[model samples]
Target: MPYALPLPLAPSWWSRLLARVPVRERRPRLRVVAAPHGGGTAPPTLTELYLARRLDMVRLALFLVDDLPTAEDVVQDAFAAVCRAYGTSLDGLQDPGAYLHTAVVNAARSVLRRRRTARAYVPPHPGAGAPVDEGLLLAEEHRDVLDALAELTRRQREVLVLRYWSELTEEQIARTLGLSRGTVKSTASRALDALERKLAKRTETGR
Candidate 1:
């Protein structure tokens, strides 16, 4: 019953993974206000921000958590947290966009943490297979890359996704993940090497 932002259509494999999220009516727009800076462009109202960045945040969450419904929940929780902390107008927050990005990352981590704890007490159940569409095509290479990413440790996946997919700088990734810049750089390097190994092995096995 929660609001589900429709994932945008794209040829990327992640888009395939996200294609079935149900759409919901958007909440009414909040009043927009001038940004703190004089003569600067106004910061987006919470609704505007949701419209513009929801797809990207969902992509980030999908990569982190690897499930469409859970990813949607993570993003919704992120926006709710922002609204709770800064209100709908988002007044007084110097960098609301960055804050929202961090919120998504943190929310995804919380989901993973809670999932881990739940698994200790609950029996694992097979997930319902998402219905596949013949019309929604994904490249084989894209599928391979996603499979490779899944083999990565959570920190490695976070570093690589933030670095390459999100196009965040090392410092930005460090800030979002609460790691030192050096640690981010090293993790990215090691993650890339491990990913390459996995992809290469897959290729050889397929041959």
Candidate 2:
């Protein structure tokens, strides 16, 4: 009679372990165990991770990119990149959540870069018509704020958006943008001042 090896733990066991841990402690760290009958060990897949964090990722991307469809595309591309780079198993990734966040941010940046390039290549005609942005859907009160937001430089805008919209701490923003905490603080301060000045100017002009 042939002896059979013990089957590996089910994915639910890993999910339970994850649920018990605090959010900050929930890093990817599953071991691969060889199956009894098969080629090799199958590590945990990204499916659970996707299901758990997809909505939050989409929101984050939306804040960065400012369009729902573009945000969705950015998130989908981020997940696809992660899968391609790490495989469906997400093996060897220490923090897949962080990886996804960074990927989405980078993708959003790329979209902005392309927009800037396209704008430079195509000069606007006098009173040229343009497509309405979805930002118009925001309340009238918010339009002023968004207009002021658009006046800020890209780096300033990113710092403000990540700080306020995403509510990430200075340290978190520093790590995400690969900048020093001091830089993040200074940039945020300057961005806020710039926004206040823009809003003030807008109010004065309206009166």
CA lDDT of every candidate: 0.73, 0.65
lDDT of 2 by residue, 1-207 (tens): 211112242222223322332233132444446756894665456886687667667656755665667777888888898898998878777666667777878888898888788889999555332225433222233445656766788778777766654556788778878889999999988987887787778778982
Top TM-score model: 1
Off by over 4 Å in 1: 1-41, 131-141
Per-candidate TM vs. native? 0.75, 0.65
lDDT of 1 at 61: 87
- Clashing residue pairs in candidate 2 (N, C-alpha, C atoms within 3 angstroms): none
Task: Mark the 10 consecutive residues where model 1 has the least summed lDDT.
Answer: 131-140
Off by over 4 Å in 2: 1-45, 124-141, 204-207
